[model samples]
Target: MSQILKGGCYCGGTTYTIAIPDKLPQVVGTPHKVPTSILDHCGKCRKTSGSLFQAWIVVPKPWITITYKYKEGSGGKLVEFQSSAHGTRSFCGACGTNLFYDSSKKKAMVEDMDGVVYLVNVTIGSLDEESLTHVELVKPKLHVWWDHGIGWIKEAFTTAGQGFGGLAKYPTGDVRQSPEELI
Candidate 1:
């Protein structure tokens, strides 16, 4: 059988399925290992998710398929917001469930691949609970915008051993510095 991951919005108005690539690593004792998962604590992500940090699973756009269960007399469509100049965030129009984040430009290049590949960062929270049998695989590998994160959240990431050096730092003075300034 083909390996597939299924998920949907809170109200079930939006659903999706992802075809697991064979190239993805497999944990010996776990069902899967998401090699491209990361945690973002950027101001924009915090405001958008209303959380201290947002866990995201990055995958090629071609691997995912989305479906919308529109309400009676409502058009079946997912709402999208240009979160930044280079990225767009999508959500369920009916229930306002945040679903996806797509970059306007292809950010990475695959040497073996023929053409550019666009990546879509999906919120792990939107995934179906049952579909995440190997929940360990979804653990954030790295923390981005760590400097912008609250002191407690940054400490949590450090305790978890997922904090990236340089970017992750204890809050000292002003915490509103842009990520570019930190770099």
Candidate 2:
């Protein structure tokens, strides 16, 4: 069965509920650690977010849902950046919240085969782990772009079993359906 997962921004100005599909498509990329502060590791992220790295999950676009009313704030709507010609990142205007990072550029970018759509990654600091314990379904699988990560984060979660769990040996070759089944 499918599940409804709810999350929102820091000020509660925006709220979202995503209908997670029961099956996740198999992912095609091999998990690798990279030395970078942000996946979209560039000057834009550092200046906008005032942080070294932005926490993100690389997922397909179809899986994301942003509340219509909350799409923008008093500052203005999120200015999407074509980080690369193929990827996009959305950031909040008012508070500089790093909202979403998606690789889907357009319908033309979508692939024919079934695969995991998007990353359901949330801001580690933005979320209250105790409150969302049950809903905190997925942990960081492979810490990509480790170069930009805060020094403390790596040192804290690096312990083998402390901050990791779920599947043994992780999934391989693009998910065939929605990750809802695993949840």
Candidate 3:
């Protein structure tokens, strides 16, 4: 129950089953709690993903294992990209499906309790919605690299209909408490 998690890419050409320990290793676990972000990557993500942003859940690399085939091309050949300083960007080169980023080899000076190399980020858009909904594994609480985010996105997520100013984090426990009272 603790080690198995599943997900895949947009076209299903690339699928992944990862093995994540209950206690993730250091580099992987470090970013999980402090508002790990979903980056629209200023418009780059829109162009690359052809969507709003590069939606991903950053987790511990060692906690994750590449369990399935990550292939590209019409022939189902191996597709990979030497992208980013942190890791490899893999996908179905045939369809250009953004599959996964393997960041385990990326150097992190910090040591983790699990003592494993970490891969870190996974695209949330590629995962199974039914599974994601139950776990809440990838709902982004904060948006980063927004200075370059889509123009309308800020307006959409930040629309002030209920007198909410759209700060990054929201308060907890009370729904009816007046803003003034809570503060």
Identify the candidate with maximal lDDT.
Answer: 1
Alpha-carbon shift of residue 10 in model 3 (angstroms)? 4.7
Candidate 1 vs candidate 3: the lDDT winner is 1
**Model 2 clash tally, residue pairs:** 26
- Candidate 2 residues lying further than 4 Å off, grouped into runs, are 28-53, 70-73, 104-131, 147-183
The better candidate by TM-score, 1 or 3, is 1
Off by over 4 Å in 1: 25-35, 111-113, 160-183
| lDDT (10s digit) by residue, model 1, range 1-183 | 446778888888889998765567433333434346788989988889988788888766777999877788654468899988998998888778888989878344433334566768899899888767756456667777888889976775567555554464535777787666765
Native-referenced Cα lDDT, model 2: 0.48
Q: Poorest 10 consecutive residues of model 3 by lDDT?
A: 28-37
* Clashing residue pair totals per candidate (backbone < 3 A): 0, 26, 11
lDDT of 1 at 182: 62
lDDT of all the models against the reference? Answer: 0.74, 0.48, 0.57
Q: Cα deviation of 88 in candidate 2 (Å)? A: 2.6
Residue 6 miss distance in model 3 (angstroms): 1.0
What TM-score number comes out for model 3?
Answer: 0.63
Candidate 1 weakest ten by summed lDDT: 25-34
